[model samples]
Target: MAVTLRTAILDDIAPVGHLHHRSRRSAYQGMVPDAALDTYGADAAARWWVERWSHERDTHRLTVAEHQGRLIGFTYVGPHEDGEPATGELYAIHVDPGHQGRGVGRALIRDALDTMRERRCRRAVLWVYAANHRARDFYEAGGWRPDGVGRDGWLGPVPTPQLRYALDLTVAAAEPATPAAAQG
Candidate 1:
């Protein structure tokens, strides 16, 4: 049941996209309409990822979770143009539907956080669908607090609201207990 976390390479592109598309569709099926999820196909996800990851000027980091040489989950981190230098956004955190609840997410996240720290990022941010209670609970349990919620009408198949979560790594480090370190 052990999962290894490491920096994702170009060779990981396909599997990463596959995991994202599958997990997103499966996880968002009930919360999001089938048509919306269908709009986000594996090809589109792969194209988006390739554009970002292939950019030399990009400071984005992709952390992948692997077990028995197969990718099961991944987390992507990168600088946010609209935020401070210490601010980074977790673009995506996904685990295969069949591999959920087996600690792959935690490993992927831990690796992403470590990369953020190396980038001198003081805070991390992400957006999750408001209707996806499972994702909300997962992020909340990982110490992310809801900072805001808004409708991304142009961005959703369901036109549902999205909740924003923010976590201050500086404050997190000052605390007596650092979950990332313990989890690692």
Candidate 2:
């Protein structure tokens, strides 16, 4: 099935939340404690998304990838809170486990990059768990590089190390906006 990308609406909150919960659970299984993962339930995620979407809809861009009629992946982009005016952040990206290894994640990331470029962002940054090589590889393949910066963070109750990844959007923006159909 062909995947389509579109801006997320209020109606997508639940499914996006569900995907977020599932993705985190699967991706952070060994990194985060099982109890902490259990605490990140669909309800909490849905409420968080609802609040964020309601409060920052204008400043943040939420895009989802759908196959047929079901949303299988999503990405969030916004101004980096700790960055300069021209720096954007790839806040989050989640793909349903069922859709993993497909092109959904790559498409969602491309859409977010295009959106950031449209916003005149010159750079983008994201943070990933230092232990998550899978995620690190994905970001690296997408042209993001670690800035040699890391920090201690809490994923629920467990403290973990996180690495910051940076991308030069000025170069990415110069490229065509078409999303590549590559596996992520």
Candidate 3:
């Protein structure tokens, strides 16, 4: 089935939440304690997404990837978390584990980069849990490099070490056909 990427609407909150929970658990299985993973459930994820989107929609972009009409992945991007006007932050990217390694994540990432480029940001940054080797590898493969900064982060009330990664967005490149322009 062809995977389609598009901006998420209010209607997608619930399913995105569900998929997020599944994705997180699958991705963090051995990296995080089962108890910590359970601290935030699907319903809570749904509500969090709802509240977040409601407040940040104006400044952030939430793009979702769907396969056969089912939500399969999502990426969230916004202005740099610490108010850096020329930088953007990739807040989250969650892919349905079953649908991973099939280019959905790459597509979403391309879309996010395009969006940040459109927003006139010259740099982009993200934080990843230090123990998430899979995620770290993925981001590194995507041209992100750690800035040698570590910070105290949280995952459902569990304190976790995180590293900040950055990408220079100022290099001009052909705009790839992304979700916003190609599909939605």
81 in model 1: Cα distance from truth in Å?
Answer: 3.9
On a 0 to 100 scale, what is the lDDT of residue 158 in model 1?
62
lDDT of candidate 3 at residue 98, scale 0 to 100: 80
Best candidate, lDDT-wise?
3
Q: Could you tell me which 10 consecutive residues in candidate 1 have the lowest summed lDDT?
A: 175-184
C-alpha lDDT of candidate 3 relative to the true structure: 0.81
Select the stronger candidate by TM-score from 1 and 3. 3
Q: What is the lDDT of residue 150 in candidate 3?
A: 88
lDDT ranking from best to worst?
A: 3, 2, 1
Per-prediction TM-score to the true structure, in the order listed: 0.85, 0.91, 0.91
Instruction: After the best TM-score superposition of candidate 1, give how far the Cα of residue 152 lies from its true spot, in angstroms.
Output: 1.0
**Which runs in model 2 stand beyond 4 Å of their true positions?**
173-184
Clashing pairs in 2: none
Clashes of 1: 0
lDDT of 3 at 166: 88
User: What tens digits encode model 1's per-residue C-alpha lDDT throughout 1-184?
Assistant: 8888888888888778777788877787776668887886898888777776788325787888888998888887888647667888888888887788766676677677777877888898887778877777777777888877454742344686776778888765322222221110
What lDDT does the true structure give each of the candidates? 0.72, 0.80, 0.81
**lDDT score, candidate 2:** 0.80
